[model samples]
Target: MRRGTGHLMNTSVTVWRVVLADDGGGGQTEAWAPQGEQPARLSQPTARQREVGDQENAHLTHVVYLRPGVDVRRGDQLRQPGLRLEVVAVFEPSVRGTYLRADCTSRQAEGE
Candidate 1:
């Protein structure tokens, strides 16, 4: 998540939903969605140099669109209206004009 200087000045924050896989053997792999308001403060960022695109973008939202630990496929759900997206390809923004997409298989979301 990138924010402009102004947004940072205003104490910008967001929520991240990461999937944790279960290793079997009485273990569980559940996705974690932080409840309530949590401030996201990065002490040392992997990305140092900031650019114009570093500014706040609409794609990153305060809430997780796909939800946590939900078995989502390539043609899963979409958040934005008129926003055609897919999970088929994972894109790295640093790679220039590369667009990311994904395709969900028959995998069921853990704890779904």
Candidate 2:
């Protein structure tokens, strides 16, 4: 994969970061805060890929590709309409400037 291929990212997704905010009762509460939205390519992994994830205990359901240096991280949530995916891991190509890949698990959205 080469850099500057904008067409590869056909879909958009909002990135949510998990923040621990202080609760009024002197406790910290976890909240999802929207970082921003960006173009991405999302796809369901094949059986072989799924099996690899399963063996690694990642339970990956989807793979998201974004521009290299995107701020996505493990535990971040990628949302689009009725879908919400929890990122299990983030991978960068050793060659650099290729693309960022996030292995995610699909979770049920509240409205769906």
- What is the lDDT, from 0 to 100, of the residue 9 in candidate 1? 26
lDDT of 1 at 74: 36
Estimate candidate 1's alpha-carbon lDDT, on a 0 to 1 scale: 0.29
- What does the lDDT read for residue 42 in candidate 2? 97
lDDT of 2 by residue, 1-112 (tens): 3447467999999999989999999999999999999899999998998999999998888999998889999989999988899999999878777889999999897756
Candidate 1 vs. truth: CA RMSD?
13.8
Separately for all candidates shown, the number of backbone clashes (residues 3 or more apart, or on different chains) is 15, 0
lDDT, residue 91, candidate 2: 92
Question: Could you estimate the TM-score for every candidate?
Answer: 0.21, 0.89
